[model samples]
Structure formats: structure tokens, C-alpha cells
Target: MTGERYPTTAEVVTGARELTLRYPDLCHLGVVGRSRAGRPLLMLTVGNGSRNVLVVAGPHANEAAVGGATVLRLAALIAATRQRGEDDGSAWHFLLCIDPDGAVLNEPWLHGPYTLRSHYEHFFRPCAAEQPEWLPHSGEAEAAALPETRALVGVLDWLRPVLQCSLHGIDVGGSFVQLTSEVPGVPERISKSAAELDIPLERGSSDAFQWPSPGPGVYVMPPPDDEVAVGDGAHSTWAHARRYGVTAIVEVPMWACDRAADTSPHPDPEQALRIAGAALRRDLPLVAEVLRAIAPQLGGGDCALLRTVRELVALGPRLTADWDPAVRALDAAPLPPMTNARVTSIEVYAQRVPLRAAAMLRRIADVPLVARLVDEWCAAYERAYSPRWIPVADQVEQQARSVIAVYEEMHV
Candidate 1:
């Protein structure tokens, strides 16, 4: 078994190379690209077969856990498979570190004592344009069009992987996983695996969480509209892979580990790594199973829900005018390029409009279906705005009660 310790990116590379040298027939190393500081973006191939699986990490600088865990796990997997004297000979190729520039910027504070607030302020506050991961350059037309992206794009084009998982972490919130393409039976398997690991199953993006009862793998939410653009350009792995006939594209949240007891600081980094590593080792097989089940129905659904969401956002300014003038002011202001005005409006409504909606729901429309839809939508909004699901639900319910009390007082 690999040592239960946190390995730096350099150490991971050295260790991977050493493992490959020891098991020449089973392992090989390839340079995909270089970071801004000229660190090699390495790709490691385990097993001799042709089934390529690509895992990318550290697309965003602050989300280092994804990349860190991925490299360490890849190294460990290679070593273990070789020692077992079992060359399964599956062609499993991993683009282990896709964003070395972002990873490096985050490495300095890996073992530091900075609070989440300070960490965000120091390392994550940069606008996407300023970020090396998102900023576009001469050859690329998106933010963070670094050399690392080019190498990744090249590999995806060459390999045409069957599965692509991009690992990311949220600073605060319950754990969740996202799949671009929904597969049959996959949701249940993911939920079961996450439950075993003690992580909740979520759906959609983090912005909207009106997930139905059988959630995917964590909370079901929608991605903010602005974040969508980050996935559109050439620098985006999802966009590039889809073009290359790649089937499964998922973003796995780091916090959603079976063993991640809490997002709070762990007294033992080794234990944390072990828990996370074990979770991945166990979950990947489940993920592979889901991929096989969903392969037939690829690209089947009409993304009408997403389109409806866009329409609702476009109508937000008009809706907010009667209740809050600040909405108009914000809409009229010269906002930054990447800011999503709609999301801001929804956030404001989460803080202010629930009471009015609750009263209106109770009074104007007592129809069960409409009321239920309204309640579910409101709950979803609350879940998105607040990190803790229970408290956010409680506060929203209290506001609803207050609205009812006010209506009764006015009547009296």
C-alpha cells in the first residue's frame, strides 16, 4: 500500500517515474504540456490495454484538492497494480495534472494555517481574466488559455477517451457530483456508493437545487449562467472532449468523499488522504459501471429546463421592479463582463422575496399542484443560497409563517 501522506506535485511526478521504471511493461510516462513556471504537465499510462480514461484536476487554482488527490492516487494505483503482478493490460491513460499553473499557485499554502477567508482573499480573489487557468492568450480565446490547456486538448483529441472526470472542490457546502450526460441506473449506483462513503447525492449545478427525490450523487442544482461560458471555449476540457466523441464528462467534488467527516481542518492529513483515496478507488468502478449503462442513450435529453432557467433570468429585472428598486439599479449599472445579473437577482430574492411568495402561494393560489411547485422551487432556492440545507429550510419556513401572521394581523 502507498504511504498515507500528502505528496507534493514534484514528489508525485518523481514517484510516478520511479514506478514506471520499475514496471516498464505495465507503465509509461508522457509529457502533455508545461505550466506557466515551466513544470511538466505529465500524463501517466497504467495497464497496456487500449481503454483510455482521462482524469483532470486543478482547473481552478483554489480547487487544489482535486488535482492533489488525483496525482497521488494515480501514483499509488500504478505501484499497487504492478506489485500484484497483474497487468490487467487495460489501456487506462490519465492526464493527471491538467492545470499545473493553478496547482502551483495553490501549493504554497497547502500546509498553512490560513483561514478559508484569508485563503480566498489571497489565492482565489482574482477575476477569471486574471487567473492563469481561465485567461485567454494568443492561441486560445478564453481566460487562462495556458500551455497546459493546449497539451490537454491535444491528448483528448488523440485519445478520444470513453470517460473524462474533472475533479474540483467547494470551500463550503455539502458534497456533490455532476454528470453532463445522465445514464440510467447510474444515479442509484452513485447514490449508493456515496451513501456507503457517507456523502449525500446531489444533482445539477450548485446554483439551483430543486433536485427530485432520486438525486444523482449529491444535491441537484444548476450552474450559474456566467460559469457556463467558462465551459464553452477551447480551453474547456468538457467542450473539447465532447467534440472528440468522448462520452462521460463529469465534475467530481472533492468534499463529497465517503470518509470526509467534515470540511473542517483534519488533525491528520494522512488520514484525510487515505479516506479520500479509498473513496476514489471504490467509486471509480461504480462510475465505470454507470458509463456502460448510459453509453446507448448519449445526448438524448432536451435541455429545455436550462433554457427555461435562462428565460426566467432574462425576466428577473422586470419582475423585481415592483418589489425592489435596487434590482433596477443593479441591472442598469455597468457590470463586469463575467458577472451573472440573473444569479444576483435570484440571490437577492432568496434573501427578500420568499415571504411575499409564501403569502401569495397561501392566499392567491391554494391549488395543490401550484402550491407544491412553489414550495419546491422556494426550497430549491434556499438550498442554493445557504450551505447548510436544514438551517436554510428552517429560516425560509419561518419567513413563510411570518408572512401568514402579517396577513392575519392585517385582516383583524
Candidate 2:
């Protein structure tokens, strides 16, 4: 299976170029820009029509593998349709591997047997503000702070697509979709596709609870004007895409767990969330201690990886911060609704403390003491979480088909 696994960042670039050459008229390969690491960022335009659609994938490095596969597959599908003279004024522009540097960092895990432990070992998710796809920029403010991010903004500015889909995946959780607008028939198509693939639909999370679901597995994407949108106005892909037309975020699960879909009401949900937050807050000191203890041994090598881990550790406190007031605010608000899925998700997060800490620890911890600590932490996390990992191929198939189904519905 590993031999036939998804393509890497380089392979994606190569494949895009080859596709353009093969379908000269239907496909046009162009450079968006270079990545931070000077890797060529390419886009493959798959149709020659007025209705522009932008499909972006591998915005997050860790997600590059499967996301790249999906993009490539979709490009081929669109190209075949175009070759057959089936194009009905639908043009697609594919931004392939926006964050090549990040993808390089995560290239080791592109092949299958993508377990949670393996994924966490090579995991690297940049801060919301720092990520190439999530950077803050409004209406051409000179240039975006990150070149990788700026390239994407440039494409959006040039295309002004009527439909946009950002390909993304979660390390865990069931399949879900976030749409800028509730387009007719799209949600039903997503539900049907995911059902056929046997991907469990994400039931209810507090984040999605605020927005009503048009159908199963689909949530109304929070708008830029929403108070919850990060970094004022320029952080989300949805923010930039909304000015043009509908934007969709298709989040297929990397792994499946039945518990992720449980929607039964939990007793005293607000207090439970508070308790979980408190537990996370309490774990901060231990995380800092471990980081401090292993700092000397980590050395100067792998600066990029080290910086990412440092950022992750730093984020722990800021996220933990100022929650007590919010918790109290929630407590007073006439018992907010809660679901078993939400509670279980929180429980999973709580159990992830040691594992998350260990992920950082393993990267810099060449020492026997630190290695032992990682092992102990992993064992503890496994005991608590009881992770049941589904095959990576299953997830990939489910995601690609689900997204394609939505795209088909969009065109219809």
C-alpha cells in the first residue's frame, strides 16, 4: 500500500506540469509564486471557460499528501470532462501545494500507515496568523506578510472565482463541510457522498453549534463579520472568497472513530467544558517544565522544526488564558446546549495533553531521559484515549469522493 500511496509535494508539482503538457489547450500550468523555501508554487488551470472556480490544497503542510492527491485527481477529472467537450462554462484553477516548505517538513509521513502517533511525530501546524493560507491581508495591502500566503491572495485577486473550495483535513474527527452560503443541493450531495463512503458525519461541536447545519455533515461557515472570525478580517480563506461568491471548506477526517458522532445530550455541559479547560490550563506548567528541561539537549539543528514546536508550546498559554471569565459567562447563560460528541471531543482533547507535549518532546529529545519521558507519555495517552485508527486509504477515498460530489452539485 505504501508503494502505491499518495504523491509528495515534488510529485504534485511534476504531475501538474505533465498534465498541462498532455492537455495543452485544456490545461495551462502557471506559477503563482515561490514558497518560503524557494519551491515553485504552481497552478494548473483545467478548463477554458468564463465561470472560474479556484481549488486549493496543501495549504497546511501536514495535509499536503492527501490533499495533493485529491487536487490532482480532481484536475484529471475536470480535464477529461473538458477533453470530451463536456465543459459548460466551468473553469477550474488549481493552486497546488501553497506551503511547500511546510510540506517538505511533513514529507516523511506522506506514505500510508498514517496513524495518529505517526502523524503527531511529524506534525507541524503553524499558528492561525502565521500560516500561508491563514495570513492577514485585506484588499492588496502592499504585499502579504508571508510570500506563500501572498501568492494565494494574488491568485484570488486575479481569478475572482465564483466558486472556491479549500481542501483540508483533520488528524482526527469525522467528516464535515463548512460552506460560506447554503447553496441548494450541495449539502445533500455531501451527505450522500459521505454516506456512500461510510465516513461518519461530525455531529455537533461547540464551534459549529453556533451555525445551523443545512444537512448532515455540513455547517454554515462563519462569515468574516462574525465575532468568532480570527485576526479581524483577513485571516480566513472564506473571508477573501466571500466577496466573489460561495466558498466551501471540505474537511474529511484522517481517521474514524464512532464516538466522534455521538450526539446525546450530556449533563451539565457548561461546567464540563470549564473543567476541561481548567485541566488544560493545569497541564501548561508541566509542558513548560518538560520543554525547559529538554531545551539544552535539543541543540541548534532543525531550527524550523524547533521553532514550530516552540510556537506550539507558546500557544498553550495564550489559548488557556482568559477562559475563566468566559467560562463564568457561559455558566450564567441559562445552561448552554451540549452534546455527547462535544463532551467526548473535549475529553479527547484533555487526554491529548501528554501526547501533544510528547510530540514536541520527541522532536528535540535525543536524550535517554527525554526519550523515556516521551514513551511514558505516549503510553499514558494510549491508555487514556484508546485510539482506534482507520486506514489512511479509506479516509483518502472518502474525502476525494465527498468533495467531488459537492463540486458536481455546485456545477449542477
Candidate 3:
């Protein structure tokens, strides 16, 4: 019932409390830890079975579809099973929004005419360096860690749950599942659920983060030693994976299309990636330079969001340099036949984070150059990608169902 549109932070918290109030014997609500902004970090516990499982969302702010939407949906599903005397003997622990402060910044589009325009217009994600889930792995730095990270760590230590699912979502594309440890039938189960829900499996590589894809829609988490460079560092899903049975990072697309999973060989293999690389090479440097120039104008005021905008914009040249050369090599390699997923990867995935950063910068500062850039890019998205909005209900269903499907597999 909570998934027609994304639930706001208040609505999510209230729902958890209400669930606990209505079924006090079955629901246990407790404060996990306080967030950086002094918000109480809440965790809702359901069932008293032997297996302790943790499902959390809101590690990335703007991914609200899975933030509270999936968590609440998962709760409702499990609760219904209990009412039907279908208990599975697995205690489920849930965190609706692990990063409450960051999530609050994304509430505007949560109650929306969900669209690419509306989403980018209101998007906000913390810089990678500053994300609570990926802080550097240094004992000395632990003291200065963001409270959100500490809160997450606190819960992880306390639960020591054998199974964990840290939920996430993409603005576009289709269902992709990541595992710190594999469950034999999980990938097939995810594909079946996606097909049933009409969400395709997004098998293409993402521009933002690339991991080892071992199956149709499954990504294997990189080893912990390489975690800092390729995956979430110090305190994250990987941390839980080391101490738990299997940690799953389940991602569902906010928008979907059959093209996401299409395997038909593309007419011009590698063209879309090359084109995307070219566009990034041509435009990123200019945005980076302009933002670098005006950065000092924001004197005496600095926080995560401002720092994130500046850092990502400044990183444009490096991003383009790395991307262009890699894609160019694809031109020479005897690569497998291209597919429609390549177009989805290039048009939507490649430009997602940077474009979102551009929109965010304009919101923070109305610089003419930045504003013009964002306007031009938005037009390009409409003309090239045809950004369709996947209904919120579909996203919630896919995310929640995927988690449950895997849990049921573990049970069996």
C-alpha cells in the first residue's frame, strides 16, 4: 500500500511506528543510533525466529524508491505472511532510511509526477568520498566518521545477522542484483521475478560503478581487499558480508524498458558507448573548469552537498579520460555482439551521475554557464533517451519481492 509513490521520510517513520503500535507483540521499534542531523535512526524488527536478517535502504539519497518504499513494502509482505500463519522462522530487521539527513533532501520528487525532468531537477547524492557507506578504511578516521555510518555500523555489530540485504535503486534501466556471497539459485530467481513484474534484467555495465557480472542479472561483489577502489569501503554491505552468511545488494530500476535486457546484436556495435565517451570528453572539461572558477565564490560556506557538487564537477575530466580510452579499446577488441542494453547504458547510465550533479549545482547556484549546460542536457535526454517513468508500485514490488525470494531460497 505504500508504493504507488515513494514515501516521504516522515511517512516512512510514522508507518514503522504505527505498525509497531498496532501489533506490539509482533513489531519492535527501537532507536538504532542518531544521525548527523540529530534525527533518530530507527530499526523495526519483525518475527522472533532464529535467523536474524537485516534489510536497509537510503544509503544513496535520491534512490527513494528503494529507500523507504522497498523497506516498508518488505515489512508489509512479511507481516501479512505472519497474519496468515505462514511464519518462515527468520527474524527480519528493517531500516527504512539509514541516511535520514540525506534522504530528507530528496523528498520533493518522492511525492510526484515522477519523471526524468522532475527527478534530476530535484536530485541530490553525497560525494563518493563523503558517502556514509564508503568512508575510508582507517582506524584513525573512524572517530571522525559521519554519524550515519556509525549508526549503520552500530546496528550491524548488534545484529550480527547471518543474512543481510542492503537495498538500492537506479533512476533508469532494469533489475540488477549484487552479491557479496552467492546463493546458488538467487540470480535465476531474480530474473524470474523481474520477468513476472515486467522489469527487464539490466545486464549492461553502469558508468557510475562497475563490478564483476557473473550471470544474466547478477553482479558479484569485489573482494574486500579491493573494496576501497571498486566497491563500498570501510563500513558497508561488504563489511556485513564478511561477518554474515550472504549480503545482497538488490537494485531495481525507477524506469524500465525491454531494451534494457535486449540481446539482439546492435547494427553498429560500440557506437553508442563511443558516442557517449565523445560527449563526455567534449563537455565535461568545460563544466569542470567553470565550476572550479566559481567555487571560491561560495566562500565561508561548505558542507557535504556543496562539496559533492564541486568534487564531482571537478572530476569530469578524469572521468572522461578514463571512459573514452576504455570504450575506444572496445572498437578493436573482438567483443561479443552489441545489444540494446548498450544504448541504455550510454544514453541513461553514462551521463546519469554527472548530469544529476549539474542539475544539483544549478539549484545551489544560478551560474549562467551551469544553468545553460543543465538545460541543454535535459533536452538531450528527452530527444535521445526517451526517459520513461516506471511506476513506483512496480519498483517496490520488484525490490521487495527479490529480497523475499532470496530469503525463501535460503530458508529452503
| Highest lDDT model number | 3
Tens-digit per-residue lDDT, 62-174, candidate 3? 77546687777778677777767887777889987778888888888877877777777777888875566765456656777778777777777777777788788887677
Model 2 CA deviation exceeding 4 Å by range: 1-4, 137-144, 206-209, 229-234, 268-275, 296-302, 318-336, 352-354, 368-388
Q: Quick one: how many clashes does candidate 2 have?
A: 0
Taking the tens digit of each residue's C-alpha lDDT, what string does model 1 give over 155-227? Answer: 7778876555555544333334444333344455544544444443333232332322234443222232334
Task: Identify the candidate with maximal TM-score.
Answer: 3
Question: Model 1 clash tally?
Answer: 21
Q: List the candidate numbers ranked by TM-score, top first.
A: 3, 2, 1
How many Å off is the CA of 88 in candidate 3?
2.9
Write out the backbone clash pairs for model 3: none
> What overall lDDT goes with each candidate model?
0.43, 0.69, 0.72
Query: Model 2: how far is 252 from its true place, Å?
Result: 1.2
Q: Give the better candidate number (2 or 3) by lDDT.
A: 3
